[model samples]
Target: MKKVLSIGLVRGVLGQILGTAAGIGLMTAIRTAMGLGWKAEPAAVLGAFFGVFGFLIAVGVVTDWWKWAKGEETSEAEDFQETPGTRRYFGVSLDHKVIGIQYIVTSLILMAFGGSFALAFRTELASSGMQFLTFQLFNTLVGMHGMVLIISILLGIAGMANYLVPLLVGARDMAFPRLNAFGFWIAVPGSLVLLSAILVGGFDTGWTGYPPLSLRAPLGMQMFFVGVFFNGWSSILGALNLIATILRKRAKGMGMFRMPIFVWGVLATSIIAMTATQLIGLSFQLVLFERLLGMPFFDANNGGNPILFQHLFWFYSHPAVYVFVLPGLGIISELLPVFVRKPLFGYKWVAMSSLGIALTGFLVWGHHMFTAGIEDYLRVPFMYSTLLVAVPTGVKFFSWIATLWQGRIRFPVPMLFVLGGIVVFLLGGLTGPPNGTVSTDLHLHDTYFVVGHFHDTMFGGYIFPLFAAIYYWYPKVTGRKLNETLGKLHFYLMTPAFLAMTLGQMRIGMLGMRRRIADYDPAQGFGPTQMVITIAGFLVTLSVLFLFINLIRSARRGEAAVGNIWESRSPEWAILPSPAPAHNYERDFQVVGDPYDYGLADSQFVELLPQPSSDD
Candidate 1:
């Protein structure tokens, strides 16, 4: 009983309840004094803010900072220490590895939640008439589905970054260990607040949360804004920590070029997170202020421009697509050479292409707004820039194919997922130009076609690759591999189902089915296609459920993996033991050879050095 109470997760939840009550009371008291009635929206906002602070305090992330404020000195080594049981994972542990595991668990939970909502809505759309969910409920589900899944993706990327980057760079831990923990811990409260939207009157504005519509949305809309606003801190601070760690903490002789290809993906992603995430935060806050303070930031009736909101929103949102995919794409590149037993065909070009994609991602946000009535000349520029992304992206796809040509290919579960990602993402890529081109976009905009295109990009670029990464690295994280048969079942079932769902969506969309509507017009001859899409959605859900079952069962009873299971050149596999120790490397190491020189005989990627003598 006492041990459970002492756990960080329990304490944080209790703290959140107390803090929320305190905030609601304070707001109610202030309103009483001002002769105004109590309002749920304002109270919820202040409560969410205080609740996050309370959770952090309870979790002890702020403990060291509190001591430092009083001129106290603490041992820096404390940050590297961790408790030896499952309890360590439930609280604020300074170990980067613990934090990384925390990220993976939380991300998977959110994915299931968001995906369930997707299935519910897809059921309602099966026959076009309202089945179980209300019209407003349907809208809320669709919007939350998008935003929550996005949060999952961000957390997923962070998990991969925290676990892999330090090991790759030969550092003991991140540049700032406490900050890394803090960045992760904050997302917990933020996600809770976001989910709280469902309890209140749900909001109807999509995740975009554009104003005018957003201004008039239910009070739950504020929670969405506040939740994302709080989560943004996680993204921003995490990026800062990663950038600093990569730049300052490389092993001896490990120059930027010599770092793992995935590190370049992390570098590019962190750049976008650092600079561009703020725009989304700022845009959401503008809407919050408009709602609470009676401001008119997007109210055209009060002299505000709705179009301006789109500009601010997409500035981060579009580049955020790159934020989502670059790491996943990097995972694809990093793993292909291993499975194919060949060198990455153009290592430097692939690395440079990540930077190119990051830089180019910023300029292409305007393409999303092409149908939204931007200037005529601006559309042409945006069109050209949007197309330019294909060049660097093409570099990646071509490089991957070249690396695989006539090599000794092994199709493990991870490799199967990697190959699947290429084909699906290519579908996404091929479908993109129609939307990027002004003429074709005029027909596809706001339709199911657009919905299909986005899903392809998301799954291929992030979700599929995420599965590959998890499968590839599961042995290193847990000294055991997932069930191979179940994994192959997952991949095979999901790929075909997803293809059907997205393709059906695109096809119906072209025949005049709109996006985000609860009921479709039966008169449009869309009944058969809608039913198929719904069935496909459920199949995808089933496949994911199998994956979860495999993970749980495998973690405890699967075959033991004591050493490098993948037979790869990366330091984590080639040198470290399976389920790497608390202190990742007992002795310092130096980079000695190429990261992906798979075909070369008698070549080593890193050379471990002896620990320093204590007597000296």
Candidate 2:
């Protein structure tokens, strides 16, 4: 019992419970003193707020800072040695690798919850007459599914950046390890609060939570707002940490351009995450305040412009897509050269393209408002800006194709996912212009077609690349390879299932199926298509199950992979052993050549400095 209580996660959760109770009691006391009755919504919001801080304090993520407040000194020595094994993962630690794993594991757990919500709603949509689910429940599931998966994607991005960025740059750890740990730990309680919405009365506004609708949503709305508010802190802080690490922590001779291509993607992503995440947080907070304090920020009935909400939300949310994709695209770029055994074609162009996408992403948010009654003049410019994103995106595609041209290519599990990501992302890209253009978007707005396109982008840009990264880096993290047979099974089953589902959705949507509806009329002749999508959804779920099994079984029984498994030039794989060390790089190494000069004879990317003689 003591051992379990000693775990930070357990203690944090218990702390959240106590804090929530205290908040409710305090709110009740205040209400009684004011001669008012208890209200669930305001009390719940306060409790959720208190719960987040409680989790942080109990987890000990803020312990060092707390000690610093009193002028106490905290040891900066590496502590992973003391905790030793799995226990370190459950507790607070300053190691970036452990924090990265924590973020990823939490992301997968959230994915399971989000995916489960999706499967439930997809099942309900199979035959279309709200078979088992209530109308409110269906609406709640759809919204929760979108928001939850989005949060999961953000965490997944953080996970990859945290784990790979330092190793790629030959840094000992993140520039601010404590800040990194704090960023990750805060998201735990935030996610709990987000999920707690379902336990309360679930909100009906979709994930966008547009105003007028959001103003009238139930208590759960505040939970969603508060949850996302806290999670945004993680994104903003993590981005700041990544930027500092990349700027200051590279080994000798590793100049800006010479760093691995993945670092460029992270840098571009960090730029967006740091500057733009505040808008969404502000937008959500506005709605929360409107609900709690009757602020007229988005209350249309009170002379506040509801359209203002769209601007604030999409300003962050649209660029937020690049925030999710750039790193995954980087993963694709990073791994492509290893599998193809060639230099990345147009390396500088590909790197700059990431920045280009980030810059262009900010200008394109107005495209989402084409049919939302925005002014006429803003439409064409936003349209052009939206299409401009295709240019940088096209650069990546060109680089990938050229790199694959006449190269020795291998089809590892990771390579399979990379290829799958390319195809799916291409589908997403091709479908995007229609939505970006005003005339076409007027026809397709709020339809299953848009849903299909969005899913394609997410699956292609983030999900597939994330899986590829995990498969490629698993040996480095665990000193064991995932089962190839099962991985192939996961890829084959999921890819086709996803394609079928997406295509079926687009087809039905073109045939007049709207999104977020609990039912469709039988006369619309959409039952067969919807059923196919639902079945495909289940198949995708099964494939993920296969991956989970592979991850677990292979961790213990898989083949030993202690050496360079991929034969790449990256420091993490070529120079370091499997399951990278806590401090990374026993000796300082300097960048000596191009990062992806795979086919060049006698080329080296980095050179390790020799150790000094003890006699000296």
lDDT of 1 by residue, 39-78 (tens): 8888888888888888888887888899889999876844
C-alpha local distance difference test of each model: 0.91, 0.93
Please give, for residues 401-431, the per-residue lDDT of candidate 2 as tens digits.
9999999999999999999999999999999
Error of 2 at 307 (Å): 0.5
Q: Tell me the TM-score of each prediction against the true structure.
A: 0.98, 0.99
**In model 2, which residue pairs have backbone atoms overlapping below 3 Å?**
none
Best model number under lDDT: 2
